[model samples]
Target: MSFTSARPEDLLIDAARRGDVPYLQQLLADGTVDVNVQNGKGFTALIVAAYDDQVEATKALLAAGADPNVQDVSGNSALMGVSFKGYPEVARLLIQHGADLNQQNGNGGTALMFATLFGRHNIVPILLEAGADTTIRDVRGLSARDLAVQQGNEEALKLLPQE
Candidate 1:
């Protein structure tokens, strides 16, 4: 569909995904677009930005009052999305914006679990410092530490507390 036919919220999400900071800024400044508006997948602009590693877009969305804890259709939050992608800075920004560190996804996986499963070593510490519950287990009954060990993520395993 043409840009004219697209919803303003869709345009905002597209700006976030493309890292078009200027366009995003304009959208946010317009004050009509819902920063927390979800797409078909239930992913809000902040989630899209974080998932795409669009740091500036993420910052703009958060500043626009996007709820960082809003989850997608699969139950993945912005923090989890960024963590799974190994984008520590974006994860950090999400956390700072009130993203739940221990929020479990559809698979019962938290951002910490995603970080461990993906060997996102840099993200592990940030989640930890943000008060991620290491004791939490996923659908497979695996904690972050267990996943680290299972995935042979040596760096993550080292950072995890000894069980």
Candidate 2:
């Protein structure tokens, strides 16, 4: 990504942010815009769409061959973003698109950790069912269940596997 503000990548990012499917498809068809092009923050269109809860845009991006496992500068994948945001549908989309359920971020936080820490109970099961490892610990030596316990997220705690 260059410093140019008017670049097609910028437009693509904005289009995904707004869930503008037609415009997104048009840009993808132009062949100049890389579907995985990242902004200054290393956020691709797919990451933006999934984080913003744009289900259709996310699906379109996946259909266009977006890498669901692409991480941001912080090593946060689209799955982690949606898990924290409580977008269950978006989470499922990424999972179906081959998102790594247990991929950790720079902080060693997985999607399950984010979901549990953020009170996204719905995402916890989705991740667990997809085979997320509860034993994975973050930089703080906290697992998803530990986060749920700290956050007092009873729903998440109940859903989590016993240690």
> Cα lDDT of all candidates, in order?
0.88, 0.94
* Displacement of the residue 55 alpha carbon in candidate 1, Å: 1.1
Candidate 1, 26: how far from true, in Å? 2.1
Which regions in candidate 2 have their CA more than 4 angstroms from the true location? 1-4
Candidate 1 similarity to native, TM-score? 0.93
TM-scores of the candidates are 0.93, 0.96
- Alpha-carbon deviation at 94 in model 1, angstroms: 1.1
Q: Model 1, range 111-146, lDDT digits (tens) per residue?
A: 999989998888999999888899998898889999
What lDDT is reached at residue 143 by model 2? Answer: 92
Q: Which ten residues in a row have the lowest lDDT in candidate 2?
A: 1-10
Error of 1 at 127 (Å): 0.9
RMSD of each: 1.7, 2.6
